[model samples]
Target: MVEIKIALVGQPNVGKSHLINSISGATLHVGNFSGVTVEKKEVEFERDGYRLKLIDLPGTYSLHPYTPEERVTKEFLLNGEYDLILNVVDSNQLQKNLTFSWQIADLNKPMVIAFNMYDEYSKRGGEIDTEKFFKLTNIRAQNVSAKENFGLEELFKKVIKTYQEQNKPRIYYSEIIEEEIENVREKIKDCRFDKRFVAIRLLEDDEDIYKIVHEKPWFVELLPQLNESKQIIKNEYDEDDLKEIFFEERLALSKGIISQVAKIAKRETLSEKIDKILIHPVLGLPIFLFVMWLLFQATFNLGAAPMDYIASVFDSISNFVGKFLPDGILKDAIINGVIPAIGAVVMFLPNILILFLGINLMEQTGYMARAAYVMDGILKRFGLQGRAFIPLVSGFGCSVPAYMAARTLKNPKDRLITMLIIGFMSCGARLPIYVLLVSAFFAPEVQGNVMFAIYIGGALVGLIVAKILRIVLFKGEPEPFVMELPKYRFPKIKALLFDLWIKTKTYLKKAGVFIALASLAVWFLSSFPRENIVKEYSLKIAHVKSEVKKEELKEEMRKKILENSYIARIGKIMEPITKPLDLSWREDVALLSGLAAKETVVSTMAVLYGGNSSNSKKLIEIIRNSLPFTAAVAMIIVVMFYSPCVAAMSTFYAEVPQWVWRIFYTIYPNVFAYFAALLAVSLIKLFS
Candidate 1:
């Protein structure tokens, strides 16, 4: 079968990714573009006896790159080899989206326009004449609703037809701009780019294009004419910046085309109605907070039932292993170290899924954008833009992707500040730790609220840090907030389940390898240097007639062995430093292991506390009875404010290259967390 490579392009939140996900039999592969940190996603599928490959370019506002993601998109479109351009536009916001459409259309590539979200558009009494759009722009158009999987087959057919026909766009700007384009076009003698596109870019004073043209032999000769053409356009438009003039021209043209081809059926948009309350200046923040609280409440309460079942299953497995294997290192390792550690991490799967599900729903329903809108004013006061909220919220899922999501912020300072504080958002890996600690220390009635408070408190602290960074490191006004609020729609259940499955699979995969190995290593440190303490205690317990006396003897032996183990020695060395925070040796080990991965914190605790036992209740009971309440609060605060895992640190390194900033990013969070824990312990002790 023949293969057609199409580049998918659009503005952010315009259903570009949703369209790619909607296609049948399509498999998406994500990677980075050459020499750039921006993510590149490609979707491949067999359609109509042809293999269609769609390269989902980063969502960019225009060819004039602003952010790193936009630069990647622009570079790919200008230089990368693709059979055709598949420009996806939001049908509801044609004029604004089509302004970008016109920019890409200027490339004169074979193209097809997909009016995505057509279902929502038509429901609002809006109608588009595709034939009329074709007549106006000379580009084939399809009204596609990727959410509903409507008109997708027809859209692909058009894509194939456009590829086969090799039809270039016939879009034209105003006559005056065209005259200048032609005037500069003639002087461009030898260049790889289309003469028309090059001429227009030259007129707009695009530095990237200017550099390319300047390297040519014809550049010195053409420079004079380029100046003349730019002057003429500037004089004609009464504007100093030809780029702004061209932008206005394109905007005017987009409006003109929309007026000619689109029929407006005036009706109240669902998004508008929902935004009245959800984005209301006063009620919005409170509503967002309540929704977040409810999300955590459901995650903890609903997940508790399944958590018990999973714990019981692990217990049965441990019991079965103990019955079959002889008392040896292998049996002890499996029962005491591996099984309980894995069980502790696995039991929180339901909570992770519920949390991700809520996040996915908010994103799919378009409420995520409104959330940014609702928080923009408050964020601005903290010297961050509204766009930072997306990445900050995504940090709750994982810091790796959240770091990548910071690409949407055009300003470098804004992006850097956002990346710096993402650790404070408390990702899913940290959820198990929070849940474990909360359940052990807090009352059942307030466990969910405590979890909620940890997350919100971290976010609050992040904002304060952002404010300080802006004042100290990056002193400037926050960038202007401009974002497209996509129309609200019912989330597809299939897509939601698929996303949740991916999250669950990723979590399990990480647990199986990273957490398992970390647990084994931790077990080695905590269980080794075989002392005679266990044997001596066993003899004493064997002689004790009273059941309580024998149980107490066993507990004493367990504590003695743990205290003398290698991990305990390591923890002891650091005890003085962490003493103010009131962290026990076991907690110090767990927190240190968390630097590797947050999930391992819980795994380390499980292996340390449960030791040779499969009963989870015993572990929780031990912690509840032994650990002081103030220390528990301090530990939670430390986890909330500390630097993320190694994987997240690597991602941050990839995103940021400055050595000074990278070093600051690494050291400051831990220092802040230590001090915060210290303060928390002190306050709690005073109040108690």
Candidate 2:
């Protein structure tokens, strides 16, 4: 089959990845771009007897690179191999998106423009004449909505046609800039880049381009002419920075072309009406809190039914495995260690999925951007950039990506501050622990409210800590907030399901390896050093004549064996440290094990408890009856404020290189959690 390689590029939040996902039969592979940490995604699919490979470059605002991601896009466009450029433009924000488009058009490659999110734009009475756009810029254009999967087939067809014709863009700048470009282009001799492109970059004083061409044989000849051309442009534009002058030139050209092709209906958009209340300074914060509370409530309450069903399913599997295998070490490990540990973790899948669904919906409907806007003022007061809200909110889902999301904050101090406090947001892995403890301790009616309080409480504490950090460690004026609020539209069910499927697959995949191994290790630690206690207990039970006496002897023997186990011994060693929180040895072990991954806490508890009982009661029931109210409260608080999993810490370390900050990030949160839990236990005990 014929293969067409297309470079997919767009600004941030322009639905570039969404468009790749919308295509039928596309297989996606994700990795880092060569020599950089920025994520690179490539999609492959077959359409109309042709195999297409789409390289989804990092979303960048301009070819003048600002962030690492933007540099990746710029480098790939200039040097990387690709057949054609598929520029995805946000239809509603044409002027800004088109400015970037003009920069890419300077590459002089086969190109097609996709006006994405046209569905939302059209709903708000915005119209784009694609034909007029093509006539003005001499590039094929398609009005498409990647969300609704409309016009994608036509868009791809145009892409193929453009490639077959070997068509390139004919974008022109103002007369004065063009005159300087021509003069520099004439002097440029043996450079790999298009002369026009080199001339423009030279005019803008691009250091990267200058470095490249400076090594060329023709540099000695070109330097004098390049300086003269730049001087001429600077004089004509009456500006010191040629880059700014060139930027304004592109902006003006974008505006002029937008006027010719775009017809604004000039009506009040639904997003605007909703934002008045949702983003109101007085009401927005409360509304955001209410929405978050509702999300947790639904995650716990709605997920309960399926959670029970999953638990029962695992119970059946364990029973079946028990009957199928003979009573031995392998059987014991599978039934007690592997089955229960994995089952405990897997049972919470419904809760994770439900929470992700809510987050995905907020993102799809454009509420997430408004959420950032709403929180910017509050976050700014705490010395975090408004953009930090994205990563902070994302921390509620997971921290690995949350750390990456911190890249949006351009200021280093702000990004580091945001990364440090993200651990307090309480990720989904910790939700199962909360659900277990809350269900065991609190009444059924208030369970959801209690869960909501835990999340909100943690977030509030995170903000306060951010404020403290700003004052003590990295004090500065917060970066100004500049964000785009996209128009709201109904989320497509297909897109939501696809995203959820990926999340579910990722969770299960992790469980199969990481959770399974951790569970087996816990089982070994708890079950080992098997002495002759079983034989001794059998002898005593045999000697006892009465049935009640024999059963009581058996129960006492089981407790003794567990108390003598290695896990219990280790827990005892750590008991003095956790004693202030009123946590028992077993609870101590579980919490310690949680440092690896939060879900392991539940798994650890399951193995520790389920090994001693053949009762039909669920793990939650057993835990509820086992722990006191104060211990449960203390455990919840500790988990809320403690250090995140090893993976999240590694990600943070990778993002921030300073050894001192890494050491601080490692030591501080755990210390904070310990004292917080100690205080919580003391207050509860005093009140009671």
Candidate 3:
């Protein structure tokens, strides 16, 4: 079987991911591009005696790279191994998207254009003549809706056919640009890229292309011609900026070609109509808040419906296994430590899933863009732009990705400030901690509202801190925000379920592996260095005649062992720091364990508190009866404001090179968290 390597390229929000998901039988592998945080997605599958491998490059608006993601795309297209380019374009944004399409077509590779979102376009009476498009650019084009599963098969057929014929794009620019391109193309020698590509990029003064061709032997001759050609084009076009000249040339070409090959849609777009109310200055913010509140309410109330069953299942398994195993360390670890700790974390999977599902829906249906636009006004006041909302919103999912998402913001000051406060947005990993505390402390009817408030409070506090950082540290005006608002559509259930399944698999994997190991270690640390204490107590319980008194003595032995345990000793060292926050040794250990991963906070608490009759009670029940309400509030406050896990911190470190900023990022969150927790405890004491 022959393999056809295809590069999938498109601008952001052009349904590129949806196109990949719609491919039948395609297998996907996702990772970061080498030495960069930009995500790389590749799909492979057999189709009609050929194995097609597709590399989904990060979305780039143009070959003139402005962001790291765009640079990644440009670098891969220029140098990565690929047999053909599959450029995906939004059918509705023809003038803009096609301008980029023309720029990529200059690469002179075997290429195909996929006019994605044709369903939406056609509904408004728009049409594209694919045959005419081919005649105009010598590149086959298809009008496909990845959302509706339209033309995907035909699109792939064209891809394979283009590869078999080794057909490259024959796109041409204006007469002046073409003449200069030929002039520069003549001097090019021993170049890996197509001569025309090298010439055109040179005319545009692309630094990346310059770096590549400068070392060539022909560069000495090409430089003078390149400079002269650029001057000629600028003078002819009456534009000083060579880059702008080329951009306008491409834009003019796009407008000309689109007019000849496509019929414009006549209807006012539904997205524009919806935006009137959704992005309205007065109502947009409140509507966004209401939508978010409802999502959290669902995350808490709907997700809690299955918790009892999950808790019971784990209990039954523990009891059944405990009956057979001998009274030994392995049995104790499995029953009292690993099983219960994992159960405590696993039971919150529904809450995490609901939260993720809500986020995915918002993104898929395109409300997230509107939310960003609505928030831009507020973000600007804090020295951030609408683009910063993406990473900040992603922080609700996880900080590692949120930190990576910060790469989208071009300004360094905006990126750093957004990253610094992502921890305060409270990631999904911290959900279990919040849920555990809220369920234990708040009333049943108000649990969802409390959950919503926790999220809102964290976000509000994060905004305030961003303002402070901007005023004191960054001290600059934010860049103006411009973003494409994709049309709203019904989310495909299959895609939503697939995304949920991925989230579910990831959460379960962490529960079964990382959380289990952390629990075992926590159990071991808090269980041992007490053999003498245990042996001493065992003697007393053994001598007792009354069954009730024997159980009491056993409970006493458990407490004594826990108090002398290694983890407790470790917690004791932090007593002075946490004491003012109304935190005890167990809470101290839980928070400490949380530095590794937030899920471990609950697991550590489960291990610390699961002593007597734990097998018969839920972790939440035990926690509710054990800790005071004020301590729960303080723990929640601390978790909300503290430094993120090691993975997120390392990501921040990697993204940011300066040690001074890294040190500030590392130390400020914990300092903020401590004072926040202290204040919370003090306020509660005064109120009570």
- Number of clashes in every candidate structure? 0, 0, 0
What tens digits encode model 3's per-residue C-alpha lDDT throughout 1-688? Answer: 9999999999998989889889988888866799765558899998889999999998888898867788889999999999999999999889999899988998999999999999888988999999999998999999999989999999989999999999989888878889999999999999889989988988888999999999998899988998899889888988889889888888898989988999999765677888889988899989987886687677666766787789899999999999999987789889988787677557657666776787778878999778778877778876777768767876786675567557656656778889999999988789988888898888999999999998999999999999899889866554546676778878888888877776566445533454456556766786888779978987898898999999778767776776788877889998877888778889998887787678778877876786433442488889989998888999999999998876567567767868899899989999998888888889889998
**Candidate 2 RMSD to the correct structure:** 5.8
Q: How accurate locally is residue 679 in candidate 3, as Cα lDDT from 0 to 100?
A: 85
lDDT of 1 by residue, 554-639 (tens): 76676677667877788889888888887877888888768767877876676667543345567677777767888888889889
Tens digits of lDDT, candidate 2, 1-688: 8899999999988888789889988898866687654668899998778889999998889988876678889989999999899999988888899999999999889999999989878988899999988888889999998888899999988888898899899999989789889988888887778899988888898898888888888788888888888888888878999889988999999989988989875554577888889989799989987887787677667877797888788889999989999977788788888887687567657766776788788878888777777777777788877668767876887775577567656656788899999999999889989988888889999999999999999999999999999999975554556666777767778778877786666555643455556556766776676668777887888888999898778767756665677777898998988888888888887886786678778877776675333342487788888888888998999999988876566567766768899999999998999999988888888888
TM-score of 3: 0.82
What is the alpha-carbon lDDT for the whole of candidate 1?
Answer: 0.82
lDDT of each: 0.82, 0.82, 0.83
Model 1, residue 226: C-alpha shift (Å): 1.7
Q: Kindly provide the TM-score of model 2 when superposed on the true structure, using C-alpha atoms.
A: 0.79
* Candidate 1 TM-score versus the reference: 0.79
**Deviation in angstroms for 416 in model 2?**
6.6
